[model samples]
Target: MKKCLKKLELKIYHVVKGEKIDGVHAGVYGDVTGIWGDVTGIEGDVTGIRGDVTGIWGNVSGIRGGVTGIRGGVSGIRGDVTGIYGDVSGIEGDVTGICGDVTGIEGYVSGIYGDVSGIEGDVTGICGDVSGIEGYVSGIRGDVNDAKLTDNERLSGIDVSQLIKN
Candidate 1:
């Protein structure tokens, strides 16, 4: 009888093989054809895979993952920009963060809590805060908040008719 019809042939077994499958199929004499394995998550667009990626990513061509909010232009950047709150424009390199706000014409920054604006170059911070108008500033530690005097910084002793008010 054709060797008992190859011993009543019927073969079906699946432990896990996926594209989409959903739960609850215990052992012994198993046969799950396709589609039913409680797929909790997975949706559009993913490529490669290496390390460290958290949330909210868009138009990312190159980032090793450490950028938190508001990125525009970004022609070139190298590394080490941490815990940024907001606002960074045309950076060349070198920024170490605690808080935010850096508008650059040139670069080289260190441990700024907030605020450094440059039209030319060279800003060094310790407690770090300066508003506008600079031709030269060296080693500032706290409060230079909203300083605007640029007719060569009003020649070091300001009072040209109280700067034309009234």
Candidate 2:
């Protein structure tokens, strides 16, 4: 019985039991659940621990939005899907959509998967075993845990970033 924000022009949203779809587009979080479309904008932590999700066409999981959690455990971005794991983080326009502990030494994980937080969660994973910060940094700033580019915890406007979490 969740509702989307009209300001974001969100067209769809589906939340099953034990899940939280808190954002524009169509965000679904729960066990054995999946999102197969453009999830352009999301809000707070889309934690879906022990769940399953597939962002078919984009990284709307945290595109302009902000999210953190495990895949199948967390959010689902566009082409940069966070893959899957026990936890995810950050909000950069990178590949793998800013993850935390998703071992992928095989592909070009343009995004990051270290200990970085979502400018929100102090709960970092992976590479953060040292200082709790994003360990990936190439071209894009990769969110280094900077608390300046965060969006909102709730929908209030059309700009996706406007709803990006803390």
Q: Return the top candidate by lDDT.
A: 1
Q: What is the TM-score of each candidate against the true structure?
A: 0.20, 0.17
lDDT of 2: 0.39
For residues 41-113, write the lDDT of model 2, one tens digit per residue.
4456755344434344533433333336434333443233343433335434433345444334332223454
Model 1 scores worst on lDDT over the 10 consecutive residues at 97-106
Candidate 1, superposed: residue stretches over 4 Å from native: 1-151, 154-166
Task: Give candidate 2's TM-score.
Answer: 0.17
Span of ten consecutive residues with least summed lDDT in model 2: 128-137
Global lDDT scores for all candidate models: 0.41, 0.39
Tens digits of lDDT, candidate 1, 1-166: 3554455777755565556446654343433343443533445445454444334333333233333433233323333333443333344434333233333223333333333433233344434444453344444444444546667657877744444433
Q: Distance from true position, residue 60, model 2, in Å? A: 11
